[model samples]
Target: SQTIHQWPATLVQPVGSPLSLECTVEGTSNPNLYWYRQAAGRGLQLLFYSVGIGQISSEVPQNLSASRPQDRQFILSSKKLLLSDSGFYLCAWGGDTEAFFGQGTRLTVV
Candidate 1:
């Protein structure tokens, strides 16, 4: 069975701190990967995505970046955090038309 694992169900970070969040999909290879952030009641916003290893695309210009270091793993990172960066981060995997999301990580920046 394919599953996505995202860590640190919740995180608290002071402003200007670095951040790294990882996600991996098991039982699947070369699946399309995505990173999304949801703020309060707003809809999920696509942050980044990958079609293959070493192939990453950013959906928005922000304080975050993503990388596909392996076929089934994706990482989101930031050199410095901003107060506006606080939100729920999610990792997902799927194909052209369907996507499966992991349990998101809620980030709080102070």
Candidate 2:
């Protein structure tokens, strides 16, 4: 069975601090991985995606970055946090048409 794990579930961080969010998929190989952000009551926005290890594509110009360290692991990071960066972050993995999402992480910047 394939499963995705994304962490810290929820976070409260001070502004200007560094941030790291991790996601890892099990029982899958070379799956397409993506990082997304959903603002309160807004549609999902794709932040980054990777088709394979060391391959990443950014969908938006934001303070976040994504990386695929292993075939089934993805990480989202930021050098410095911003108030606008607070949102619900999701990690997903899928095949051509179907995707599986993690529980999601809610981050609040203060």
Instruction: Write the residue-wise lDDT of candidate 1 on 1-108 in tens digits.
Output: 999999989999999999999999999888999999999957999999999999999989999999999999999999999999999999999987899999999999
| CA RMSD of each candidate after superposition | 0.7, 0.7
Q: Name the best candidate (by lDDT).
A: 1
Give candidate 1 misplaced runs (Cα > 4 Å).
Answer: none
For every model in order, what is the number of clashing pairs? 0, 0
lDDT of 2 by residue, 46-105 (tens): 999999999999998989988898999999999999999999999999899988999999
| lDDT of model 2 at position 39 | 97
Q: Model 2: which ten-residue window has the lowest total lDDT?
A: 40-49
